[model samples]
Target: MKNLVLTFLLTVITVGSVAAQEINWVTLEEALELQKKEPKKIMIDMYTVWCGPCKMLDKNTFQNKEVAAYVNENFYAVKFNAEGNDVVSFQGKEFTNPSYDPAKASRRNSSHQLSRYFQVNAYPTIVYLDENADLIAPIKGYQTPTQIELYLKMFANNDYKTLTTQDAFNEYYLAFKPEFKG
Candidate 1:
């Protein structure tokens, strides 16, 4: 009886720890607040409920232990719904979809002004920003966990300031391998 109880307690503890490893995403405003205190960069997962690939990226790529750990350590991660109703305030401006149609649930609402501000034309766009909330770059499309680790490291290390072109960065990425274990 004692052994059984101890085993159950251990199992519960392990599961709790695993669950806690999941990313704790913040709102864009909250991220900006954090940025004022620290120099950490920001990573925004721009997603919509209807985007199939975005779902897959969340479940497969972002949920990976290594990916989650890296992102948590290096960035103020934000999960922004492209068509969400929330008003996002940035740079002394509020962005919302004033023309959104609630009747057409499947179709996207008028995009948040911030989406247009960042030129996010597609689903599953990953936008990285500097500590000052300036656009670093907007990465379009779904990326595997391994593929994304390169970008995480690049921005985390402030390597973008040195590289002159994407091709140069691509060359460096191809030559590099992640040190973090999944």
Candidate 2:
């Protein structure tokens, strides 16, 4: 009976840990739809299956507890496959990867039109959009949770609006401290 109880408790703990690590990633359309009812900034993780750094960002940054909690609470997170065939309609236009091949889905296929629209020329770019679905910034590269925490907080608190010059951004970046452990 004690062994059975121990096993049950371990199972429960494992399930809870898994749930805590999972980020609530929504489709781009779903995020836009939700924005209509309740406004929130949108964060899109543009990645390709073939990119190693992209996978690292998923396993390290997105899975971080503090990053997951903050993003889920303050933004509508969207995971977009840059080379996928999914048709995305945004702002008044339709975007698709017309040349995307299913066989090449696991490899480097054609990029979606939306990626071109956002000018995302690299993998693992984190695109930030304002509450109205307007582009705020496209930060390219693999960022650790500690590295991304600055942008997340800056945008969430409307600090980016006041950063009109490079000097201002440098000042803010230098003065800011990160608290996220993961």
Q: What is the lDDT of residue 79 in candidate 1?
A: 97
| Candidate 2 local lDDT, 1-182, one digit each (tens) | 99999999999999998777667899999999999999999999999989999999999999999999999999999999998999999998999898889988789899899999998999989999999999999999999999999999999899999999999999999999999997
Candidate whose TM-score is highest: 2
User: Using alpha carbons, what is the TM-score of model 2?
Assistant: 0.92
lDDT of residue 139 for candidate 1: 93
Name model 2 segments beyond 4 Å from true: 1-15
What lDDT would candidate 2 get against the real structure? 0.94
Question: CA lDDT, every prediction?
Answer: 0.86, 0.94
Consecutive 10-residue window with the lowest summed lDDT within model 2: 15-24
Worst 10 residues of 1 by lDDT: 104-113
lDDT of each residue in 56-138, candidate 1, tens digit only: 99988888888898899999999998877778889999898777778855666667777888889898999999888899989
Model 2 per-residue lDDT at 76 = 96
Q: What TM-score does each of the candidates earn?
A: 0.88, 0.92
